[model samples]
Target: MRTVGLALVLASLMAGNAMAQPKWAIVVHGGAGVIARAHLTPEQEAAYRAAMTRVIQAGGEVLAGGGSALDAIETAIGLLEDDPLFNSGRGAVFTAEGRNELDASIMDGATLKAGAVAGVTRTRHPISLARAVMEKSPHVMLMGAGADTFSHETGLEQVEPAYFYTERRWRSLEQFLTQNNLPIPARPEGAAAPDAAAGLAHDEGKYGTVGVVALDQAGHVAAGTSTGGTTGKRWGRVGDSPIIGAGNYASDASCAVSATGTGEYFIRLTVAREVCALVEHRGLSLQAAADEVIQQKLTALGGDGGVIAVAPDGQMAWSYNTSGMYRARLADGEPLSVGIYKDEP
Candidate 1:
């Protein structure tokens, strides 16, 4: 009888501890591409690592402080959008016409609410505009000049079209256009003369979009994706980053997903929603779902890139087919981790 009583007490204590533990997890990705070690100088590699570390630490603080998953993901993605190293807001890649157009999407798992903006030219932070559309408007997406106009009416910070330029990205645009045998437009009016950013491989690790997926203490999941579209893309082209279910998806019933890669392929496969569908309908683990979609399905389609996900049960996973993907993660009570190469654990 004493043994049984002791077992019961211990069981109760275990349950109490479990209830007290907070469950929050977050994952971030800068981009995915043919990033080989030999291509980058040591200084270039260090820059990416330090930037990813800083972004994850900021996200961790939000989740640890009991902030919503939506807030955490938006905060993280916004920072990535601002960083010139990744291809989002500042230093975004240029279109064939020598202009930068941004796209972004955000979703709330608990409510299945989502918002997106495409071809937005003036907004400083496209992720925030996406969230504002979700909470403040009745629509799911806005596009082009209309989106920029809406941003102005909504009182979001706007920037001169020239603010997105960087010499590195400009060089990338010129290279892509030259290699493709396409007409290369003269550098935009605001761009300074190019410098020696040419030694680094332009298409190495920064080929896709920036994304964040998070599961908060409230058991809600959220995701956001932002990008400047592809280098040397058509003047009005839009990518998967701003399209929910294509590049971004969230649902409490399954998981939140943010994808980066060939936009047309992601859109055709509905990659983001497919991950959640596999989790909800096939009982797959978060990692397994991400692998199935990114590895098997996307690979069969001859596509490149990857995805990051967070489940309601605190699982966080990332999968990519490229040689390297700039990524980081942090969970409550767990140490933060950041990685770049496929060889990394």
Candidate 2:
């Protein structure tokens, strides 16, 4: 009888301790797509690793210094947005019409508060605008010229169209248009041709990337996403990056997710929310949920790429079906770190 009573007491004590333990972490992704081995040269790989390290360090510092999860997530994602290689901010791909249209979103898990901006031009930082819309306005999302107006009204820097122009993006647009028959009108009607018809081949050489989900010392969760819209996209196409449950989503009582891959398919799957659902509904582990959605479901559905996820308990997972993904993480004891390409992990 005494033994049974002692066992019950110990079990209750263990549960209480587990509940009291601090749980916090951050995971991030560069955009994801058809990442192939041949595409990454050694020098490029090294550069990616170095960039990941810097951002991870910056975000981890915020968390370690007792900053809010929002601050940490914003800090980390900003670094990736600045890197030209990832196709989010400066390196954003060109539209079919040879212009830059960017999208971004951020979610605060604690309050289930969220904000997003889509198809914005001239706004220097899409994420900043998204954050502003979340706190300053009653709206959850804004698009196109309207988004730019809000940014200007709120005192966010507005760049001219020239600020977003990049030769690389221009070339990418030209290549896509050329394949569709150069000198053709800027608009291509209907859907893009299949892989064979339009010569729509996946160029593994240029993979897209986004960044950061952080759980800070106070156990709050935050997630953010930013992306240059797709390369050679027509019809003013907007992607999942600006969609809350597709590219990014978070909840204080559950988890946070940052998604990468073919934006269209991700939107179809509602990939970010699916991760949280797996945990809350199915009671699966965080890593298990990520693998199921990013690796199994997304892959089975013919979507390529990956995601970064963090449970409220601070369990972190990064999973992808591509040849590689740009990712890095920081835990309780580890110092700042970085990872580029696929091979480093």
Candidate 3:
């Protein structure tokens, strides 16, 4: 009788240990817009896919190693900010005045603390600055020259405005101004002449922003977003990227969300928070909640954009209204998956 009782106790303990195992996952997006398969050459698609693959692996390593969701998301988003393929830091699109003005935000789900920066021109990685704002400053957001000054004081990397120049984005800026019949701003100081080989891929209304939502082994979730705002924006135009609850939100009780799309529409709808609200308030699954806000609500409002999300349970999802969205996801002990077009499974 004594032996039987001891065996039962051991069995119960083993079951509890198994249930306590952590589940981690991460999802990312480069942008969403009118990216039709017919428009992207095979080479272009491959380039984008390779970039997303690299980002997912780098971020996934952090979660797999038991890092906090906040660290994992910051690592992932900082890489995207460095990569020119997406519009966050380097290779960012230019304003109407031909200057690069960047925006970024980060949210920690475990504590609900958030940080953001807007119109930062000299900071090399705006995402890091955003995190600094959350960790170092008393404010939720800092913008324009004050944000730049804070960045300088924080000792974040700074660069000459010319460092952001790239032939691809410059050509897009030129083409955009030409089509809209706006006066062309002179080439920025220290920027090189535009290359004739640069491709023409300009769509200010549709594509451009980089974001990440990560759920770590500790069951914490976090979200981040970064962008150069819309092309040819004038008079200090800021976008949803740096706006908490608009382009980025995170909550361990529900989910973490990062969005990319037209700034005005996202701001109008509070897209990121809306997705999380559906899950917390309406008892929707991660996928269903994302679809409900992006596919139905945003679409009905005539907005075009997309969102990537991860819940504390490690459920991951992405939804978009555009023809394509540059996205990728990875779950604990699962293969990395990437999707670009609307038709992908």
Q: 2 or 3, which is superior by lDDT?
A: 3
> Model 2: runs farther than 4 Å from truth?
1-23, 182-207, 335-337, 341-344
Report clash pairs, candidate 2.
30-209, 30-210, 31-208, 31-209, 31-210, 53-338, 109-252
Question: After superposition, which runs of candidate 3 have C-alpha atoms over 4 Å from their true positions?
Answer: 1-22, 193-206
The whole-model C-alpha lDDT of candidate 1 against the native structure comes to: 0.88
The lowest-lDDT stretch of 10 consecutive residues in candidate 1 is: 193-202
Q: Order of candidates by TM-score, top first?
A: 1, 3, 2
lDDT of 2 by residue, 1-345 (tens): 999999999999999978654555677677666555576666666666677778887888888888988888878877776666677776677776766788999999999889999888778778888899999999999999999999999998787765665555566777777888855334223213221101212244434758588888888888899988787777878778889999899987678998877888889999999998998889999899999998789988998878898877888888888777778888666444455456666
* Clashes per candidate (backbone, < 3 Å): 0, 7, 0
Query: Which TM-score value belongs to model 2?
Result: 0.87
Error of 3 at 54 (Å): 0.2
lDDT string, candidate 1, 1-345, tens digits: 999999999999999888654499999998988887876788888888888899988988999899999899888988988887788998678888888989999999999999999988899999999998999899999999998988999999998887788888887788888888998887767766343333432355435799999989888999999999988888488888998999999999999999988898899899999999999999999999999999999999988889999888778899999988889988887788889888996
Using TM-score as the measure, name the better of candidate 1 and candidate 2: 1
Between candidates 1 and 3, the one scoring higher on TM-score is: 1
- Angstrom error of the Cα, residue 138, model 2: value is 0.7
Listed in order, each prediction's TM-score against the native is: 0.93, 0.87, 0.91
- Model 3 steric clash pairs: none
